[model samples]
Target: MLAKTPFIPDKPILIVCGHFGSGKTCVSVALALALKKSGKNVTLVDLDIVNPYFRAADAAELMKANGINCINPEFANTNVDIPSLGAEIHSVFVNAERDPDSVTILDVGGDSGAAALGRYRQMIERAGYNMLFVASKYRPLTDTASAALENLREIEYYSRLRCTHVVNNSNIGDETTQTYVENALDFGRELSELSGLPEAFTSVVKADFCPALAEKYPDKSFFFIDNTTRKLF
Candidate 1:
């Protein structure tokens, strides 16, 4: 069972953004699945026009099986680079606004992919949202605290929105170890301080690793994740 954490916001709109390979898509998929399992009417929007590979659309079958409504851009999973999205995307916002039990998860593309979200800024803001900026020290160009901060600002600028929380998602895929997760604690803290946003939680891929980490860092929260985005390959 996926444990629910504070990272799942009370707001109807939850936007997940991060540097490439920071695992934002995986986080988004996992969150959507968890919400569905918890009896919420969940909708996942793949707003990743920038990165053609590893999109939430790739997991459409799994999402459907789990009772999650998924919306992807029109040209997703093809060689075409057209960035057009479906008109149905509007219904997600409309439905969420009227339905309190509904939650929409936006798995934004990495880096400049957040720009795709700019056009929907007004609707998202009106419905209230919690934008989570995920940071991973293992990914290139965002390995340092300063670099991560710069990337966060770029996403915010492109989206025309501010991040309400920071999530430390540092990991090396299956190579992730407890030591790697522990090392990211400092990076997470630095990012929280620099951004002036609360550290929503640290996402740990290894479920068994959570108890020890939680005991050590009682002030911090950890979310256990299963790697659902890997099937995109």
Candidate 2:
């Protein structure tokens, strides 16, 4: 069984944004599962219109199996037709805001996909949602932080909501170890301080050793999920 962490907010609409391959889909799915396990009604919205790979909608079946609601465009026919896609997904933000007990997680596209944020700016601003940007120092040069912040500024200009936190999701595949997790956390803290953003909202780590790891790093708060964990304030 996966250990449940209480770091998730009860009923806020959370927008998870990151560069391509920054683990946005993985983190969004894990967060939905964790929040559901903790008895919150969680819904995941796939706004990744730019990327065809690693889409949150691709995992709709898995999410539905876990009793979580997934909202995305539907493929009704064998030959994909743009006209066949339904419009229900476009209204997610409006619907989510009406239900105070439900938490909606929006997994938006990244980098070039920053334009998608513009399309939903009105809905997001009206809903008063919170945004989180996922960052991985291991995948790119340290300058990735600056680039991500720039992209986020573009997103904020369109989405009308400032990104309030960053999630450091550094990892080295299965080779990830406790030390690697610690170093990532340290890097994230430094980056957060340098950027004048709040301390990295959380550092996501693999789950196999996180409980013990969390105990050891008590000064740094954490939230554990299946195969991954995060520290959030």
Candidate 3:
């Protein structure tokens, strides 16, 4: 296990946004799990109404089993349309912001889900959440940094919040090797510079490589993903 970083109060809201198939949910889950291990009162909120198949809510039960709070409109009231902003989410946002121990990880939807966030602009802005846009260099349409930045900007405008960081989560399924991870890191660094944002807070590495790579790249930030859980460094 790796040591956890202190959670900043103003950074309570963590918006995970990205284009479709960019692995936003995976990144968000990894982040939430890592924070929970560090003893933070983490809340993983699934706000991705657009893509129903690859939703963060799909792993809600597992997340809750590990003591992390998983909040999703569907979980509270399945009848309510996932795309519609309801009282359940609003209340969660309010309470999460007031509770100092709360670290809300919002797994926002893809481009189509942008409209849903428009309804909660005030809450998001007031929460002072740190937005992280995931950019996968291996993804077909998003291979170019310029296109990825544009997509991120669209999400930012729709969500009414500026993205503070970029996370490079590039991979090719089980075949993802160390070289692929390094390529993502290098691409992310260049993208950050191009977008005038700070360096990527971290890069995601498969769990299989954690044991060996963790010790090798002790200085660089990393997020680990496995069959059962996700963790951070």
Candidate 4:
């Protein structure tokens, strides 16, 4: 543990953005728990406006139970597709600038989610942040490194923020097997190299897989977050 650097960053703000179906929301929730458990003041913002599907906000109860500050849109729990922005959404940025020891994670919807972030571009720029693009090889539009780079460019252009890292959250929910996890790390590493961005880590939902992961990819880091909610969408 002395030599192992944890997946959580020391930075105050982290933006998790990716193409639709890349599982950025799962990574966001997992990341919030990881940072909070590491002893940092942590807040999670559900800024995913495009996907009406269940998102980070859906894990509010679970997050709150674990002591993570969860900020969700007004209509996050409703059937409405209209994107709602609450003033509280800016609190994370405020904390980002004021609280150096705090960590804030923003789980964006998709490329469009990053586009919605355009409304807060000035604040985001002022607060300072590190954006991590989550990619999954099995997901459409990012199956290949070239395609992943293309998606990255599109999101960066819309958000006006460059990606600082990549997170390989390549999982097919409970169906994700060890073989898939192993393959994803390799694919994610390739994506990382092509994007000229470092991969923060690959995630596994089961803690039992850690030993096998360590044995197979001795050079990589990982996060084990068991999804606590059942998907309704």
Candidate 5:
């Protein structure tokens, strides 16, 4: 079971963005599952036109098994570089409005990847949405609080959406541990202070190493997920 984290955006429509290799895909997957567990019909869109690896499309089968709708690039899971998204991407918002109880989670491409999302700005902005920037201190360009804000501004400018919050997703691949998670909380706090955005929560993999820390930090919100989709360097 995922933690009842305060970072989970309660909006009916949400988008996740981050610098390349910041583990936003993992956060997106976990978010969709979390929303579903909360009893809302959830739809996850993978707008990762930047990196082909570590994308939400990779979890389509698993998401389907769990009753979550996933949208991805038309050429996803293939070698083709085509960045066109399927028409179904627009349906997420429509369906959400038609079914007030549904939630939509858009897994935006990384920094440069935000350019791909500019095309949908109208549809998304007109309906009003929140874009959550996923930040990891371990990643380049986001190692410091200042670097994080710079990247966030760029992502916001490209996506045409302001980020309402930040999600600290710093992790060292499969080697992540309790100590790393605790350290990430500090990083998250610094980022929140610097960026003027609330540190939504620390994201951790729901693997063998996380249980103790997760149980120990009851007040701190966390959104735990399966880390299999992460691109381990």
Candidate 6:
């Protein structure tokens, strides 16, 4: 096993959003778990009111077992598709903003799903947030840099918030390879140039290959995904 590199959120409110099938929930789940493992007070909020398949609430039980506070929509994990958010989210944000040691991660849904974030624009703007825009080159419509940038714009427009960083989460699930990830490096570089956003990091699922990729590109940061949310499928 490779010695893991920790990914700590600089801002207390860290928002994770991206296009459909970009693995936002997976990244959020992995990140929340990582922060909690590092002894930080972590709260993971499932802000996904769009896609029902890979919701972060799918891992709510796991996160609670790991001592991470979790909040999900009322109809989450059910057959309903309501965009209902509880009043507790406001309290969580208020507390997180005041507590320096606390970190709240929002696993937002895709383009259309980001509309749920618009309601909390004032709260997020007041507390300051670091939004990570995830893009996958392997995904259907977002395979190209131009396509990905367009999707980012839609997400930003819907959320009424801008992305602070870009994360290349390109992978073909368990079939992801070193070569495929290398291709995404080029895609990420182009996307960064186009969007004018600094890269937060790239995510790789295979622990064995992650070390080699990290060594190959010392300038870029890499986070090894532990494949937690895949069980939702």
TM-score of each: 0.95, 0.82, 0.85, 0.92, 0.91, 0.94
Show the lowest summed lDDT stretch of 10 residues, model 1. 1-10
At residue 225, what lDDT does model 1 achieve? Answer: 82
What is the Cα root-mean-square deviation between model 1 and the actual structure?
A: 1.5
Reference-based lDDT, each prediction: 0.89, 0.67, 0.71, 0.81, 0.80, 0.87
RMSD of each: 1.5, 5.0, 4.2, 2.7, 2.1, 1.7
lDDT of 4 by residue, 5-77 (tens): 2476746778889998787877787777777777888898888888886688888888899899988888987
RMSD of 5: 2.1
Q: In model 4, what lDDT does residue 213 have?
A: 87
Stretches off by above 4 angstroms in model 6 are: 1-6
A best-first ranking of the candidates according to their TM-score comes to 1, 6, 4, 5, 3, 2
Off by over 4 Å in 3: 1-10, 75-82, 211-219, 227-233
Superposed Cα deviation of residue 220, candidate 3 (Å): 2.7
What lDDT does model 6 reach? 0.87
TM-score of 5: 0.91
| Model 5 C-alpha lDDT per residue in residues 90-137, reported as the tens digit of each score | 897788568877778888888878987788888777666777889998
Q: Which of the numbered candidates is closest to the native, going by highest lDDT?
A: 1
Q: lDDT score, residue 116, model 1?
A: 85
TM-score of 3: 0.85
Q: Candidates 2 and 3: which is better by lDDT?
A: 3
Worst 10 residues of 3 by lDDT: 1-10
What lDDT is reached at residue 216 by model 4?
75
**Span of ten consecutive residues with least summed lDDT in model 2:** 224-233
- How many residue pairs of model 5 clash at the backbone? 0
